[model samples]
Target chain A: MARPFVPTRMEEPITANHREARPSGAVDTRVEGVVANWFPRFLANGLDYLDVTRILDAIENWDQWGTTWEAAGENYEKLGRDALAAGHSETAGSHLRRAALTYQFAQFVMTGDTEARRRIHLRMADTYRTAAPLLQPPATPVRVPWRGIDLVGYLRTLSDDSPLVVLIPGLESTKEQFSTFEPFLLERGLSTLSFEGPGQGETWYEHGFRDEAYVDAMRALFAWIVDRPDLSGRRVALLGTSFGGYLALKSAPGLPVEAVVDIAGFFDLKDFDNLQPVIRDNFAHFMKIEPAEIEDVVSQVDLLGTLPLDVPVLAVHGEVDPIVPVEHAHRIAAAQMNATVWLYPDGTHSCNNLHTIVRPAISDWLADRLAVGA
Target chain B: MARPFVPTRMEEPITANHREARPSGAVDTRVEGVVANWFPRFLANGLDYLDVTRILDAIENWDQWGTTWEAAGENYEKLGRDALAAGHSETAGSHLRRAALTYQFAQFVMTGDTEARRRIHLRMADTYRTAAPLLQPPATPVRVPWRGIDLVGYLRTLSDDSPLVVLIPGLESTKEQFSTFEPFLLERGLSTLSFEGPGQGETWYEHGFRDEAYVDAMRALFAWIVDRPDLSGRRVALLGTSFGGYLALKSAPGLPVEAVVDIAGFFDLKDFDNLQPVIRDNFAHFMKIEPAEIEDVVSQVDLLGTLPLDVPVLAVHGEVDPIVPVEHAHRIAAAQMNATVWLYPDGTHSCNNLHTIVRPAISDWLADRLAVGA
Candidate 1:
C-alpha cells in the first residue's frame, strides 16, 4: 500500500489581497514599479542578479513613484543584504517576497515576478497569520499523471475558447500554488491548466512515483490532453516551471505539442547529477530509493542526448534564479532549433508574480497563437 | 613515483596542411561562410531542426542584396541537409564545424554564433586530424607535475613587462593545446602561464584531481600566483576553455585575480551532473577517485554559492558548442557583477583558433585592464 498524502503547511492557501498594514508611511510608487518589473526581466535575462539590481535601482528612482512601494522595495533590498551578510537566504528571500507582493498591489504596479509576487503576498499573510479577503482560491481541480498512476490536481481555469495551455509545476509544487497565474489568465480570455506531476504533491505519497518518472508521465499527459474533446484538439501549449522546464523539453520531442515554454527548467540531467547534494536536497524523498534503479530510469530519460523537437519553444528564465540556474534555459535553447528565449534580469525560478504586466503579455501571446487557431 | 607522461600520436607535429591536397572544387566558399554564420545563430536562437531548415530556405531564396558572403552562405543549406541525413551528430557536427571555422577566416564574416566560430577553429586541429599541418605544435613539451600529481603546470615567461595571465585548457587538453594562444599572447606583450588542471593532462594520472577538486586547485593556484614576486604583483587574468569556463567562474570569487576570460566555459555544475556517463567517459582521467573524498573536500571550495569577487570578467563562448553549451557563459555573466559578455554565435570554445580573432580581442582587453597604472 502507498503512503497517505499529507500536505505541508506551506501548501495551504492564505487569503488573497490580505495587504499587510503599512508601517506608518506613504508608499513609494517608484520602488513598487521597480519591484513589479523586476521579476519578468530578471527571469527573461536568465536570472542575472547584477541586472536585477540595476533594474531595481532604476525603478526605485523613477520620477513620481510612490513612497510606500519605495519603502517596501527598500525592505527587500535590505533583506537581500541581510541574507548575504547572515547567510540566511530563506529569510532574505522572505523580504524580497514581501517587497514583490507589496509592489504588485502598490500604485506603481509591477507586471513581472507574478509568481514570486503572489508567493510573497501569500507568505506575508502566513507571517501575519491572517488571510486576505480579496484572494480567491482555485475553482476546479484536474488530474496529473506520473508513470501510469494519476493524482488529483486543483486547477484555476482562464478561457475555454483560447488554446489549452498546461502549466507544469516544479519540484514539490502543487496545482494550488498556480493560483498566481490561473485566474489572471482566465481574466484575459485564456485557458490555463496547472498540474503536479510525478514525485510532487499527492502523487509521491499516493502513487509512489519518483522523479525519474516525470518525463514519461508528462508525455502521457500530453497524449491525454491532445485527445481530449473539451480541448477540441487545439495545439497544446506547455509552460514548465523550474525543473518542470527540463521535463517539458524532454517530453517535447515525444509529444505532439505545438508550443513549449520552459521557465527556469534544467535541460541536461547529467549536469544535475554532478551536484549530488543539490539533487539529494531537492529530491530527498525520492532519493531514499535504490540508486541503481534510479540511475537506470534516469538514463533512459536523459534529455541532453535527446534529439531536437519539431515544435516551437519559448524559454522564460531568470538571470539570477539561485535554484534552477538560468544556464538550463540556455542549454534547452541551444539544443532546439525553434526556440525563443526571454531572460528576466532580476527574476528567480517560479517567482514571477506581479500580474499587472505578465498576465496581459502572456494572454496576448496565447491569444495571438491559440485564440486565432481556435 | 609518477609514471612519465606519454603524449598521444595526435600531438605530434604535421609536415604539411592536409586540406591543401584536396581539390577546392567541392568547397563552396559562399555557402561555407553563410552556413557557418547562420548555423551558430540558429543554435543561439534555440531553433529546432524544422525552424532551422525553414530559416535556411528563407535565407537561400530571399532576394536580398546578393553579396558574396550571402551567396556563399547557401553552402550551409547543403551542409544542413547532409547533417540531418547523416543521423550521427558527429557527422553533422563535422560539416558545421568546417563551415564555422572557414567562416571565421572569411574576410566578410557574418556576425553570429561568435563562440561557435571560435570554437570550431580552435577544435579544428583536433576534430579534423588530417588538418594538423595548418596548426603549429606546442611551444613547450608536456611535463608531469611534481610528486606524481595528477596534473602538471608551468608558468613560462612570455615577457617581463607584460601582464600575468593563466591559460586553462579544455577537456582532454594539455598545456601544449594552447600553442595557438600562447604565442599570440606573448607576441601581444603578455606573460602567459599554462596548466593541465584536473582531468586534462598530467593531473588525471598524477594528482587524481577530479571534477570536484577543479575549483579548489584553481583557488590554490591563484593563492600561489598572488604571492609570487617574479610576477611583480601584477594583476592576474584567467583564460579558460570548455570545462575551464566553470573553473574560471568557480574560482573567481575569493581569489585575488583581476579578471577571468571564459571560452566555451560552463556556468552551472549541476547541469553537467546529469550526463554522468558522458562526463565520466570524456573525463574518466579526472574522476578515478573515491566519491567520499570528493564530498568531504568540495564543500569548502564549492563555487555555486555566492561568489565574493568584484573583479572584471569577460566571457567568450560559442553559441553552438555541442560539448560545453553556451548557457554556461550566460550563467557566469548573470552571477558576476562586473562582467562583459562577448557572444560568438557561430564560435565554439576553442575561440583562439578562429583566425586569431579572440586572441587579438583578449590581448587588447588584457592590455587595457592589466596594464600597470592604466
Candidate 2:
C-alpha cells in the first residue's frame, strides 16, 4: 500500500482523480458516524464486513470519503488484473466485483463536491464493466439507442425462455449495485436486465435529471426488448426501487411489460421537504438547484397523471421508513387498478435492512405475477 | 426445507439428535439478547449477514436455541450432501463448513440442560470432520493419543517445510470455528493445527475438564508432533484463547515449543465470580459442578506457578473486555520473563469483536516471532 497506485482499469481517465482533493482542516471523524446508517447497507450489500470495518476506520470526514474508498478499490483492481493475467478468471471476477462495490459506496452519499462524486462513480462503472464478462454466465454490456444517445445496461440471462426482470436504478444507485438482487432472479430461472436510465449511472454524463429523458428511457427500454428476438418473447416485469420506483409508475401507462413492482416509491414530492438535510442536499446535487428552489420542482412531480396502471402492479414499502411514509404505498396501491400493497413492519428505506426476506419475497411475488402470463 | 430429519453425515448417532427437544410453553425469545453480544462474533466470523438475520428472527428463546440451530445446520448438511452427490466438491465443502459453524454456535452457550448442549456440540465436530477432506488443500483430522482416549485436531498445512501453530479452543469454542483464523496462517505459509483438547469438542465425551487430562493432552500434542517425521523438528507456537489461554499458560512450563500466544488468557480465576451468569453457568456445565462449588477449582488455577517462561510470549487482551479484565493481561505480562502485551482499547471477549484488526496483528506478530528462530 506504500507504493503509489497506478490503477489497472477500464476506460481512460476523462477527469482528474478524486484522490487529489484532501480535507483542509482538522478532521473530526467520529467513527460512530458510520456505525448506524451505513453498517446495514454494507452488510446487506456484498462488501466484506472486515474490509468495510478497515475502510470505514479512516473515513471520519466526508472530504476523504470517496478518496479512501478509491484507494481500497484500486488495490483490488490491481489484484484482479494480476489474477486475470495468471488465468484465474474466477478469482479476477470476484476481486474486480469487490472493487466495483467499494467504488459504489464511495459515491453513495457525498457531502463534498458533486464533481468528485461523479469521478469516483465512473471508476465504479468501469470496474464493474471489467468484471461483467468474467462473471459466471457472463453479463453483456448493451447500449440501447435512446433520444439520440445510448443508455447503458448489463444483460444477464439464465435461459432464452425465462422471463426477463428489468431492474431500474434509484438515485445514487446504479446497475453495478444490483449484483445481490440478480441471484434471486437467477435462482428462479429468470433472466435479468439491469439498466441505467437517464440521470442514473453512466447515462448521467449525457443527460442529468429531467422528466423527458426519464420518460424516453423507459420507452427505449421496452422498444429494445421488442427488438431482440430472444428477449421479446419472454414475459417482462419492471422492478424499480425508491426514486426509480416513482419513475417506473410514471412511465407505466401502455408499457409492454406484464408486471410492475414499485419498492418504496414516492406518490408525490410533498415529503421531499421533510427529508434530512444531507439527503436534501444530495437531491439538490442531482437537480443542480438550491434546496429552496425544489418546491417548484416538487410541484411538477405527481403519479396521478399515470395512475390506475392496466397491468398487475405490486407496491413494496417499509412501514418504518423514515424517509418515505408508508401511506405512499397505500395511496399508490389504491390508485392502481390491479395493485397490491406490501408493508414490511420493520424495514427501512428500500427494505435494505430486511434484504434477506424482502428481496426474495419480491422476487417470488414477481415470479408468480409473471408466471400468470407465461 | 419441508423435508424431515435425515442427516447425511460422518458419525452414526450414539446420542439422539437435539432436534426433538422443544420448549414447553409460550417461548419468550427476546431476540435483543442475541443482538448485543452475539452479533459482533457472528459478523467478524464468516456467517452471511442475511442468513444470520433470517436465522436470528426465528430464534427467540434459549429453550429452543440448540434445536433451532441444529435444524439450520441439518439444512446445510443436506445441501452439502446433494452438492457432493452432484460432484461439486468445492461447493459441498463451503456449505458443509457453514453447517459446522451453525452447530458451533448451537452449543456455544446454553441455559437449559447440559446434555442437550453436548448433543449439539457433537454435531459441530462431526460436520466439520465431514468437511475437512473436501476443503481446498484438504484438512485432515488427526488423532493424538492422550492418557487413555484420543484428542482430535484438524491439520491444515500449506507446505511440507512450515512452522506449525497449534490453536487451542476456549470453554465452548471448538476447532470448527477456526476456519476464519486459518487464512492468515495460510497466507504466511504457516501450517495450522486447530486442536480440541480435553473437555473440548469430540474429546469432551471421554475426558471432561480436569488438570491431569488437560496437561496430558498438551503433552501428547507435542509428542505427536515429534513422532510424525513431517511435523518433527519444525518450529511450533502454542496459541490459546480464553480458557484455553489459561490452559496454554498452565501447560507452558517444560514444553517443547518456541513461542506462546495468549489471547484474552486468564492470569488467575479471581475474576471468575464477576463473570455473567450465562457464561459462569456454561463454565460450570463443562466442570460438572455447581456455580458456588467452583471456588475449589478457581483456587487451584493460577499463572504464578508458571511465571517467567523462557519462550518468547505474546499476550493479547482487549482493554474493554467485559468478561476478562485487562488487568489479567498486565499481570501475566508482568510475571513472564520474556513477554509482550498488546491490549486493544475497544475489543470484547477474546478480542472477537476487534477480530478484523487484532487477528491480523496477531498473525503478523506470531509470524515475526516465529521467523526469528527459523
Candidate 3:
C-alpha cells in the first residue's frame, strides 16, 4: 500500500479574495508570529534552498545567473543525501539530477561551453530513461518555436488529468532544471511541461532571439500546449525561477494560466529604490537600458498592479537576499487574493533542501486543485 | 531583588572556548530554529526598529556625519513610543541632541556653510542642555584633533562605576544613532560613551579628514576612553554599524575591547566579486582606490584573517540585505571560532525590524559579562 500523503503545516491560510482587497491587517501579524516561532529549524532544513535562492536572486538582478547556477547545482547534490534519508526518494532523485544539469547549464552560460552542456544532456537522457517507466506516461519531447527559434521541452502525463504546469528556465537556463521533478509528478498522476524560452539555453544566441521576445513566446507556448492531443484544453500552471520568475509573472496574465509560481522572482525591471550605485549600474547594463528607463519599464511590469490573475498563485522568497528584496514577494502576494505566500526565513530563490519543507505544501496545493478536475 | 535577571528563551548558552572557537557551531540551533519560525511575526512588530537602524547606519557611513545630526534628532522623535516601550529613554534623548549637533556638523562639511553650522551648533547646545541629564554624564562639549583640525563631540557620561560601553558611529554619522539606547543603558547602570569619529559628523570637512583615516581616529578615541577616570579602565564593548562595523573590527586588536558587535559588516572589501556596477564605482571612490586595488586593501582589513581575537565578538547580518551580502557574515563566522554570529533571514542592511529579535540577545550577553565583572 502507498504511504498516506502528509501535508506540511498550513502557512497562513491561502489569501482569500476578500482578504486581498482589504489591507493585510491582522493576518500579517498572525502569520508573522507563526514564522518567527519556527524560523530556525525551518532554516536549518532549508539552508541549501536559501543559498540557491540567494545566488539565483543575485544572478537574476545582477545578470550573473550563469555563475551561480554551478554553485547551486553543487549545493543541490550535497543535500540529496539528506532528502533520501528522509524517505523523499523522488525529491532526492530530482535534486541529484538537477544538480548535474545545473552544473552543465552553468558551464554553458559562463564559457559558452557546448561540449560540457552536451555531456550533461547525455547524463540527463540516461537518468530520464531509467525513471520514465515509473511515471504515468512516458515523458515526451516537444519542440517549441519562438521567433524562428526552436526550443526543446518535455511533457509528462498525469494519473488524474489536471492542468499542465509549464516551467520556464531562467536566462541561459535549459529545460533540465525541471527534469528532476517532472517524473515525480507524472508518477503521482500530475501532468507537467517544461521548456527553455528565448534568450535561454539553445534558443537565445543559438537562434538569435533577445529577452523581450520571451513574454510573447511563452504565451504562444501555452496556446500550443493546450492544443496537444494528450493535453487538449488543459489549464496551465506556470512556475518560473529567478529571471524566469520575473518572466513568469509578466507572462501569466497574457496566457491561459490557471496558476503561477515565482521563486525569488523580480516584480519590477527597475532597480530597488534604495539600490547601491554598483547594483544600479550593473543592472542597467544587463537590462540594456539607461537608469532613467528602468522606472518606466518597472511601472509597466509592476506586480503590485493586478494582472487579472484568476487562479491561485504561490511566491517563495529568501529572507536575507541581497539581490531581490523580499518586498517584491510581498508586493506580488499583496496583489493576489488567492495567493499562498511561503517565506523561508532561511530560504532563497529556488528551493533546495528547504524544498522538502515546501515540497509537500506545493504538492498538496496542486493535488487539491487538480483533484477538482479529476 | 532585581528579577534575578532570568535570561530570555532567545538567549543561547555560551559553550566553552572550543565552541567559541567554532562560532558557527556555537550558535544554538534551537534558538535559530525559534527565530526562523517567528520571523514574520518579529517583522510585523512594527518594523520601526529597522527604520531607526537604517537611519543610524546611514548616518554613520555618511561622508559628513555632523551634517546629518538633525536627521538623527528627528528619528529620535519618531522613535518615541517604540524606544520608550523598549526601555530606551536615554537613547531617545541623546539622538535628539545629536541630530541638532549633526546638522551643525553637516554645515561644517558643506564647505561654504560655516555660518549655518555655527547657528546649528548654538541650537544643539540648547538641545543638549535640555536632553543631557537624560543621558549618563549629561552632555558636555569636547574637541578632539584629527589631521591637525579640531572636531567637536558631545560627551554624555553614565555613573563612573558603571561598565563603559562606547558607541562608534559610521562614516558620516554623529553619536545620535545611539540616542535611543544610550540613556536606556545609563538607567540600567551601564555607562555609555558616543563620539563622531574622524570623517564623520563634525570631523569630515571640518578637519579636512576623508574617510580613509577613520581607523586611526577610532584607535585614538578608544585609547583615550580607556585612560579616562570615569571609565575606570574597564574593558569597553564596541558596537559598530556598516562602515563603522569594519572600523570596529579593525580596531579590535588595538583596543582592549571586552566585546565587539558588528551589524552588516564586510569582511573582505575585494570579495564583493559580484557587486552591482554603480555601487562598486561609488565604494571605489569613497575608498580612494581603483577597483583593482580593492584586493590589496582587502588583505589588510579582512576580518576573517584578523582571527584568534582575545575579545568576544558578535557579528549580525541580514540575509536579504541588498548592500552587503549575507555571505560576508557567514564568512566571518566561518573564519573565527570565537565570534558569535546571528543572521536575520529576511533582513536588509540596517533594517530596523531585526532589532526586536536581536536586542534581547544583545542585552543578555552584555549583562552576563557585566555581572561577571561585578
Top candidate, metric lDDT: 2
Worst 10 residues of 2 chain B by lDDT: B5-14
Q: List iRMS for all predictions.
A: 29.9, 17.5, 27.4
Query: By TM-score, who's the top model here?
Result: 2
The residue ranges of model 1 lying beyond 4 angstroms of the native Cα positions read A1-138, A144-148, A158-160, A208-212, A223-228, A273-279, A286-301, A305-307, A350-363, A372-374, B1-374
lDDT of 1 by residue, B299-360 (tens): 33334564424777777766655556766666666666456777665454444223223454
Query: Residue A275's C-alpha lDDT in candidate 1?
Result: 47
Please give, for residues B42-102, the per-residue lDDT of candidate 2 as tens digits.
7666676655655665665666567766776786777677767855455567778888897
TM-score of chain B of 2: 0.87
Of candidate 1 chain A, the 10-residue stretch with the lowest lDDT total is: A7-16
Predicted structure 3: lDDT: 0.53
Kindly list the per-residue Cα lDDT of model 1 for residues A220-249, writing each as its tens digit.
676666666676555567777766777777
Predict model 1's lDDT versus the native. Answer: 0.49
Q: What TM-score fits each model?
A: 0.32, 0.59, 0.37
Best model number under DockQ: 2
Off by over 4 Å in 2: A1-41, A44-106, A109-374, B1-37, B289-293, B372-374
